[model samples]
Target: MAELRRENQKTTSELKETQKRLRQLTQTIRELEEENSILRAQALKLKEDTANRDLSFSRELQQMKEQLQEKSCHVSLSSYTHATVPTPTLSPAAKPPTPPDPGNSPIPQPSPTSPTLTPRDSPSDTHSLPAAQPLNTEPNPDRPAKPEAQVVLLMDSNGKYLDTKRLFPGLITRAKRCQNRGQAMELLRQDTLGNPQHIVVHTGTNDLHTLHRETAEAMTKMAKRASREFPDSRVVISTLLPRTDTPPHVIHEINMEISRSCAALPNIHLAHHTNIGTWDLHDGLHLNKVGVRAFAKTLKDVTLDRNPNSLAHTAAPPRNYRPPRYQQERQSNTASHLPAAPRPPAACYTLPSCPTQPQKTPPPSPMDDLRLCDEQSHPSPTH
Candidate 1:
């Protein structure tokens, strides 16, 4: 009985100890949870603070930017206001008297004592005033003539494709657009503006598909008429540019016809754009930026009459002639060990009136094997 009592007492003590530990653990858990809640609130507040700081900073930056822009605008406005002051106009009475011409004979001087007459003196004094000479309407031959303007005639674009004026500042560019050669001729006829130093006609690209031979004839006639109309100025007939839609041979034929016809006229010169290729054009018809730049340069050259020897008259090879890449390939394929064939001498196209002297051909090298292939491909023209 005694042992059983002791055991029961020990069991009760262990249960008490376990209960005390459980209560302590509960308190610790509650404290941890409170601390966690506080930490969460603090984190949330910190995030909000960060967000507000960023937003405020952005707003401040935006305000600064706006202020800077306003300052710049104000500065520009002030500068413009200060720079463009209106010039005061002088009335006729305020204008200084014209200096007497030395060429005219001097009037006899009145006696110094002769009543020092004022304009308010009398109508009789007005008679002593020299009679006003009638204004001369005729142009003075002695005066230096004003610089002549240059005119460029386009088909559809109104010469917007190329700005010749921007390229050549000295030149006064007058741009006019026409539909075709006929319309161009009519427009030229209607233009009452006095003769320009240079008249560059860049039309007929629009007419290639519609009219073949007639386009050439019309362009030739237009050139003739322009020459007649602008006898003092040089009439530059720009050959038809190559287009993707039209066969090159057709364009070549028309250009050849124009060349033959215009060759007789001394004042007429052809601006050959033979170097232009399909790569230069955009949309297969119109010139892109690159082409426009080149076209503008060519116009300037022709207008200034520079590079007279560079004018290309022939449609075929010789002027600006470059050997085909196939020739090099053929040479490589046929004889790898042998030296490449000597290239033909380069030549510039000249007018028939001033033909370029023939250049002697270099001796054939082992690469001449490609010449056989070339001859088969491009036979020499018969005279």
Candidate 2:
């Protein structure tokens, strides 16, 4: 019994030691969890700080770009003003010129061999009386007026749909046709886009057959560059038109990416052609007449700052359109297979509204007619 008691005491003491160790381990775990929570909070704070920094950087960059553009515009205007101003000059003639008389006076024309003289050519001419009219500010009737609204359309062959004559008066349209995104970029680089109100870039439909992600990136990059170049103008980017050869989801993804990029810029807008379906394309690639109408309308709206909803209304198919030939054939076959409805009974024709069918009767015989005549002539035995 003593031995048993000693063993029991030893076991109990070991159990108490394990319980103490477990408590220590639990405490350690709690401390580690607390540390992890602190680290997570610090990481979150770091992320927020980084985001704020990026936003600040972007704003600063935009401001710098605006300042640079303003400076450039000011410089160009100054240069233009200097170029248009007429410099003062002196002539030898002091008396006012008399009206020409065709009968006696012959106008003396300046000789082409003689060098034209200016104010700087001879200091002696500076003392002579200035011309009656030093400067004529009257507007020249022959000079072509500057366009009031300049819209730059950088697109593919789809640009042919927009007719320059039908557009608003004094609104000049400078359309550049590009075969692909690369060509579009190249054209943009080469073409000089003046201070236009809107810059429309419609591309990427041709590039969808390539890697979609890469195509999307290229599209976004092109839009960004255009926005950067024309900071004052509204940069309009058109979504890819639906093509039969490419899956709808691929085009959707590309558009989604482009939309996100456009949303990030303040001056960039999206001309959505998502309403255009496969039926709109003529050759599964280019837009047909209907599609071109809708496409042109969308571009016109964007260029003129009109409502975007017009595209959906204009792109809708006609209500009275006939179905495809295959569809018509299928429908005809199905109808042929359907059982015919039962015919109405003769009683249905009894109604006054219903037309009655004619009844047929046998013709009268000649022998019967002769017997009747003999009976009438005899008149004898009138019973």
Candidate 3:
């Protein structure tokens, strides 16, 4: 009976231990489930943040594109006006009217015996004139007159022999055909009589296939001569437009040479439409409608901006005008009698001026010098 009781006690202990282990495992599983829920919530929040950032960036890009379009539209409007308007034409009949003479006798003059009309017995009375009469209807000279500026000649070489009358219509007053450079030069020389203030050189399309180094050189020389003859005139050198059917590389090479040549000249300006690649070359060389419009707009802007007469009307300083700092300093010094601070000494030694030193004559050399000296000392044949 005592042995049976001890076995029952041992079995009861084993049952209690198994039940404690099961409770501990249940608590661990519950903690693990809470952590998993927190991780899922964080993952969902991160995805939402990423999506919001992308949306905001897309909206900003769209806004920038809209602004660019608006600016381009505004520029197009101004460009259209400039291209369509023709330059003012002057007539020979627009001469200034002569002024009426004030001494004409239309009304009766006062009697010489009258107190107001009587001349004083003085030296000033010797040159006195009769009383003025009402003048007849005549033109007045004091009226404000329009000041005449110079006329500029703009030529567009559309790569053809078409007459200027056909190409430009009413824009050009006089147009002449010239087959070669010599003929062109002759025409230019004659145009000087009209005193052209600007010359636009548009050439090289016809000579593209036949172009050589000499062609560019000749063109450059002609431009330089034009500048010299018409010192007041501005010469513009435009790059050749690309041809649609021809290879782009050939056109590119020609343009490159043109650009290089233009850069060497001071008075010549390079007008390039393809620098920014705004328009596409549809036919390879000739511009489409859009390209032509863009080209004309660029020309108008550059012409107006650089024209001396245009700047005069606006009362704006010339674009290239910049006063030297030394001039400013000189003016200030003159006004205030304040001298500028002396510059610091240079780091290297400088050679001193030896103006007073008599240039020494070196002893005669073994060859020419000695022979020439000996010949000078001893008389030789006169011949």
Ranking by TM-score: 2, 1, 3
Clashing pairs in 1: none
* Candidate 2 residue-wise lDDT, 152-204, digit = tens: 77878777776765754566777778878988787554246667887888888
The lDDT values for all models are 0.73, 0.76, 0.56
Global fold similarity of model 2 (TM-score)? 0.44
The list of candidate 1 runs beyond 4 A from truth reads 1-155, 308-383
- Candidate 1, residue 200: CA error in Å? 0.7
Candidate 2: where are CA atoms >4 Å away? 1-149, 189-191, 308-383
Runs with alpha carbons beyond 4 Å of true place in candidate 3? 1-183, 190-193, 212-214, 275-285, 306-383
Residue range 1-383, candidate 3, lDDT tens digits: 78888888888888788788878888888888888899888989988999999999899989999999998887676455333323444356654346455578576566777656334655554443334445323334554554322334334444333333433343433433444455456556634435544455555555556654455665666667666666665666556665533444666676776667667666677666553131244434455555555455445445444442323232232355443444456677797876767776774456776689788998667898878889899988787
lDDT of 3: 0.56
Task: Judging by lDDT against the true structure, name the best candidate.
Answer: 2
lDDT for model 1 comes to 0.73
Instruction: State the TM-score for model 1.
Output: 0.42
lDDT of 1 by residue, 145-245 (tens): 65546664444552576665586686676777776776777766525546777777778888776776688888888889888887888778888887766
Q: Considering every candidate listed, which one attains the maximal TM-score?
A: 2
Pairs with backbone N, CA or C atoms under 3 Å apart (clashes), candidate 3 = 242-284, 242-285, 243-284, 243-285, 244-283, 244-284, 244-285
How close to the true structure is residue 70 of candidate 3, measured as C-alpha lDDT?
93
User: RMSD in Å for candidate 2, one decimal?
Assistant: 20.7
